[model samples]
Target chain A: MESSEAGLRPPRHRVSPRARAYWAVRASAGWLMPVAAQVIWLAADTARLGPHVAGLVLTAVVAAAHVTVMPQWRYRVHRWEATPEAVYTQSGWFNQERRIAPVSRIQTVDSERGPLEQVFRLANVTVTTASAAGPLKIHGLDRDTAQRLVDELTEGTSADRSDAT
Target chain B: MTERTEWRRLSGRMLVIHPIQELLRAWPVLIGLVFAGTAGGQSSWWSLGGAIAVIAAGMLRWFTTTYRVSAEQVQVRRGLLRRRLLTVPRDRIRTVDVTANLLHRSLGLAKVEVGTGRTDRKDDAVKLDALHVDEATRLRAELLHRTPARRETAREETATPSEVLLAAVPAAWVRYGPFTLTGLVTVGVIAGVAGRAVNEAHLDPGRLGPVSTLLERWEHAGLPAEIAALVAVLVVAVAIASTLGYVLAFYGFRLTRNTLGTLHVTRGLITTRSITIEERRLHGVEISEPLLLRAVRGARCLAITTGLRVGRGAERGGSLLLPPAPRAEAVRVGALVLGPTTPLTAPLTGHGRRAARRRYTRAVGLAALVVAALLVLSWTAGSPAWIWRLSLVLLPVAAFLAWDRARSLGHALIEATLVSRRGTLVRRRSALACEGVIGWNLRRSFFQRRAGLATLVATTAAGRQRIDVQDVPLGEALRLADEALPGLLTPFLDSADS
Candidate 1:
């Protein structure tokens, strides 16, 4: 929510609950090639240790872990906050990184909703700076929330030219 | 101002100098030609004729090339068939470097190169080869002179002609040379050349009977002893080569603060170079202490300035303010280069104990991975067990280094300058002006989050874009980002909510 308090820090908000489903879909899409290879290996009878059985077990374990465990853990760690001054994001599951892009330093703010995300009414926001450390990405936010954040950040950046000094 | 319209030709002596430069550049080709002639059973006169033809073409080019300086721009017009006219705006000119190789020096001529800060292009610099030394210097001064408006403001400062800041003597070479890898590099270069020459000459090892016999005699001393003797010889050779190379490169190294608020560095034994850099363009100074150099308290200082990009095949020594000097002297030079107000000796605020723990874990993890890889290799590739054993022994050393590296990591915001120090093997201490910083980046890994740590980075336009303050608490990173650029982060601070 937009707060009237000028100096008050913004509260960290988690991404949309549909983020888990989005992540699951993305992970499964990525595993397509590996799943296909495992299937071929089992069908070809090239496996040594009851190969089909082992491959099926491994695939199930990985699919289950990605669909059930990873997305939830990722959702818990993902947090972002935007005020008039700067945008802060805490992201990543394995190497949780916190990134801050001051409104004045932001070069661009982009919000995108993919076909899958649109189906779930989810969007992603990317705040880019001239920094080599790369852009700050806030993933799986509600579509409207992502739009508002982009508008606020872009407006803040446009209003402040003094930071260039 | 009226004199600027005149188009000028390089000194007539360029006919001689240009041809020599061309010949030098094509020497490898000429060498290859001679070998080809020998192989083809052709006359030596054929090679000589080819070399002469190349030199004549170079001389013709010298005669055709011409340049002019206009009020607002400098223009170079050359090429007979495909005439190229390159015009550079006067205001965009960043540096004027005058270089003279042995032949040019002997002929009292110098090659003037004007850089415009567009380092990405190889032909970004406009070069006037074989100009009279005095003419080159005058041209350099005329081109680099500040505009009248800025001159009026700097009048008080320009009252002094030029002040000598630091000068390198013969003793400096000895003091700094061995600590650098210059010797090892020289050895490698020499080996490469010698190997190539031997291959080209089709030399036979068996023909050197005495040398082979001497090697055979040494082989009886046992492999370990023989290896020790070889290493000892290599070290001695490398030491001699490094010192010689250092002396040759920086025989008369001198740094001067000129009247135009610019730094003038002139150095070299044979070729000699004069590099001029405007003081305003300087972003900061980087003091680097390599692992070996750190042991002897020696360090090098480089100007982290815009426009002076360290380009490949270009003279990178332009940014070098101080070569190998004692750490104290290097820091003093760094302060002097930055201006009298900046003190490099001030205490730095270090990241707390969590930083050390993180570093230790990272180091141990890395060592463990290496050990694991070696173990796997020993099992699969049937490698020796001793390799893994040696890696296991290095774990403690790795831990110690990590702790040292963590201790070295520090950041301090003093006035308008932010000083950050990092590294263990090659420690670098950089002082960047707060105003120069364009953005801030805060990063945290899962392990870092568990330890309540974050890495903060400040991005600038000059030198390395990102300077990091690693493993500080997340809260501190937020505060630092705010403090470094006031009002930039304050509007976003969710202090009450957090």
Candidate 2:
């Protein structure tokens, strides 16, 4: 076995710079859930004076650490490349994934923009095959880039007459 | 049959059956209504109105539903208020299922369910609930047999398509059924339901007639002895129940390959089910051996095709080709089903020493953690010594499992099919057609990367949707992917330097 075939190299392009802020906002929103739950729990059981304050402090520390670290890690990890032959992507900060699907097998290509993504001019491009393992979602991309990718994928998919199954 | 293209209503017998079926469905509500009626006043009026409304709706459904089969497509129109029309192109039809429960059988009716390959939306499931048995058979044959070119000549062709019986095997193979351990799940379910019923009725099971005597005996016999007796009873119960379940589910089980390029499977005792699969849609076959089944050298076979799933964990399917049978029979059937040329019996390539080491580390490491936790708990909480002592037994069991898991991991690309084998407790050897593979997923965990391995998942539309080739060397994974589909990975690969 040769070094060239040793592993899948990283995909070609990184996402937009605004994606970092967008991810930070999204991550902070996720972290808020625990804080909200803790607050409601404390309110429900005001009688429990001993552990609630300590729990709240521990939760804040964990949430803050997560909000601070996750976004930057995700921004660094997320990369995508769309070629005429295939779509290659690398995502996930800890458990990294490299997915490759031939253009012939591509069933659908869609671009979605969340409410917050609109503020950051960021979007997600989803490319799917017939398999239920699910679509390849490239998150936190510039809206224009997402649109172009979708267009290119749609064109590439259409040009091939295979059933894409 | 009525010029082949005319829109037709459901069997007239449905008019009698539908309202009865609907009324039966509303039994609990009907009981509640009856109670309300006993309370007197305007409640009786409300109950009567509700009953009438339900019956009227059921009766109305038969009139609203009408279907037409044409040369190009099958079109169905239903619902009086919504008036939705569903049209499926003739070529897109992947499977045609005809099922008849006891009531439907008694009424000489069958339900026709058509599965088009695009099964992404639940709404796309096209079914006509109650059609005449004869009509249903005719419609199924017409829908599934004819190609677009041959559709016009279907009526003229008097002789039926030739059918080669792949397996008319159920009675002779009945001995293999109990080994499947399928009814263990059913036993658990029955016990759960019984327990729930006892709880709801405020009945103490321990004080029940024979149960009270059994409890007294168990209390005197000690925990281990009591558990051993219970296990013995459960095993006997499960074996008997398993045989019964198998007979009921696979009564007169037959797999037939038709001259028209369709595979037909007809089985089930109480609720008769006949599944017609388009031969072209078939990607592969899976021969699965559950632990107990493997102990007795028994295996079951499922078809890997578009449109239907191979029902996870249930040992039930819309895709089952063979129920629990001898492993040789399963292999033979699997090979025959995949067509004559497939090397389903070909030896697989193992994932080497590193993969085995990884499996051992994960399994044994996890087991050790559990044992350590139990020991720590014994020290901290002053728990019983027996529990932590029992945890020590898990170490050898976990090592055995890891060894089995390592041995089970293998994959091979034979001809145009990619054969992958994995899992220990429920070992599955899946052979998938290369053409059916839609994509490649190279997943490398942080630990897996350090081990120079990747889990290569071949994404397909059939059976579990993805066949995992776990912990293969990165080079081997790339090579397999490249060979599986030539152009898919070649663009991204670097120039090989040995």
Candidate 3:
């Protein structure tokens, strides 16, 4: 490949095909809830503010908005790559917020899933910060992907800074 | 000083202070009210007699209530009908406070209260209302001595200050006044008039039988001069009683500290209370300048606490160690009592104080408009003549607020404290330590942003105290926030992600 082509090539395309397939599974699993909620609401006939035609129009507009604004789900999120710093999940398009927790700051990792999430094999990762408040949360990752990320962050590379004397 | 490293169970006798016991102790007051009303013919003989009988029964039941204490827990069993057995662990107790009533004080007793940290329902504050002064002190000491390790595994702990600099003990007390003499006199006059009005409004013709009989007896017994003398004596008695009631209800103010860290404050002549603050829980400090006291240059300093409102610190509201002292004296005395942990000074400006005053005026102006609108509506509807004069009351309040606004402008510089003065009814100089700042928010409205002004609100775990410098340079606010963050986070750095 030309030097310019190499520069534009995306960083994670080097991962195995299985890993790419895993990323697709996680992305679709996460989008299922809003899609399901929209479908149910469409058929319920519960619109109170307007005529049925108007209700249908309103519902379509809302559904379209939700689909357009769904958070990016194609990227393969990782804890850290090499230079030794702990990685954190940075999401939320509007706020563009970032949680910078080092591997050392990982007090504990709890993986949880609700009934709906479990049906689609998706899990939630809750990360606690130092103070009692302000815990970071990453939602809607494939079960296996979530486990791998937690293991990579919790057990790999950097020294256990929590045990630093 | 003795080292207290373990939680000790309260004495078994402490259970006599349980709520049921308090209900029992108040039985006499119930009986007294019934007796007084019956003798005054305010109630029927049958109803009065029934109340007396019930009070007697309740007192009898109270004598049977009891409690038990072990090394680790306290259990109390009370109530004759629906009994409750409350068991609380000693280690879980956060604070032990004491309060005194006339009966408790005369008997040399204090109500020992235990604070459980949970806010889900009410605090688990069980009052042992009749513990001896010594017992209450020992119990408080015992609770304070319990080590943090024994309670939880938290790495950070509340440590006591050593090498004491200033402690205000009860012995160094200067008479603290809540209501000035002039204020008290005005209150008495208003109260007397109100009392007479209420009596006339509630009076019944049937209830005048005793008064008629007394008048008739006096008429037959002697000279017209004697009757006139009797009336004069009665009026004088009422006036004296009203004045005395106003003063004593607001009396016995004492503020003191030990050379060590503990501060003891006791006030209220009738219902006395002594509070001991461990100091760490004192999240913020406030010094206020009320409008009336502006010319006198008097201010009151109060501490902000969690859960309880200001001054809920065992000692009634912000234990006023320095009651209405001059500016210099207030600062000196406040710093001494607050100790070295507090910044020696605050950084505020005349401009900031003026801004604060303007804010107060804005609030008062809004109140006046509402009152004026209401009065106009009432007049249009042909309401009472007195309703027209009601709006006039807002005039004095507005003038007072304006005066307060004029006086409210003053700020001082402290290396690590932000001292801001603001108020109308109560002028306060608030001192917030940089160490307690949890987060800071810099907000700029469109106008403010254009004017190069912003508000930096430092939120502590306690509450937010906004420091607004209307024409303040924006760069300064951000720099101040940046400077404040390092000190605030130092204690929590061992665990913070950053």
Clashes of each: 10, 0, 25
**DockQ rank order:** 2, 1, 3
What is the C-alpha DockQ of each candidate? 0.31, 0.58, 0.03
Model 2 Cα lDDT, one tens digit per residue, B1-498: 458789889999999888888888766556655655565667658767888899999999999999999888899999999999999988788899898988899999999998876653656668898899999998898788776577567644425678999987758788877887878888998897666555534457777789899788789998889889999999998998898888888998999998778899999899899999988899999999998888889898989999777663222478888889898888999999897545568889999999999999999999999999999999999999889899989999999999999999999999889999999999999999899888888888889978888899898987688989999999999889999898777667664211
TM-score of chain B of each: 0.89, 0.88, 0.61
**TM-score (second chain) of model 1:** 0.89
Residue pairs whose backbone atoms clash in candidate 1:
A9-B493, A9-B494, A9-B495, A10-B494, A95-B446, A96-B444, A96-B445, A96-B446, A97-B444, A98-B444
User: Which candidate number has the best DockQ?
Assistant: 2
Clashing pairs in 2: none
* Per-candidate alpha-carbon RMSD to the true structure: 5.4, 4.1, 12.9
Give the Å error, residue B250, model 2.
0.9
Instruction: Please write out the lDDT profile of model 3 over residues A4-73, one tens digit for every residue.
Output: 1121111121212233344444455666665566556656855643565565566556655544443333
- What TM-score does each prediction get for chain A alone? 0.84, 0.87, 0.53
Question: What does candidate 1's lDDT look like per residue over B358-385, in tens digits?
Answer: 8888898898889999999999999998
Instruction: Write down the worst ten-residue block by lDDT for model 2 chain B.
Output: B307-316
List residue ranges in candidate 1 displaced over 4 A.
A1-49, A52-93, A96-165, B2-19, B26-36, B41-92, B114-118, B121-131, B148-160, B166-173, B310-315, B340-342, B379-381, B496-498
Model 2, residue B125: distance off in Å is: 1.4
- Give one digit per residue, the lDDT tens place, for model 3 in B1-498: 222323344334443434444455455444445445645755445544666566565454435455555556656555566776667776555445577776566667777666543321333345554567897776676555544355354223324323333323232222323322334455566666655544534544345888688667767867767768777765665545544543443355555553333555555567666655545545556665565455555555555433233334442353355444455655676676555534535445554442444555565777678777778777787767666576778767777666655565444446666655655576666676655544443444444444444455554433222343232344555446546654332222223322
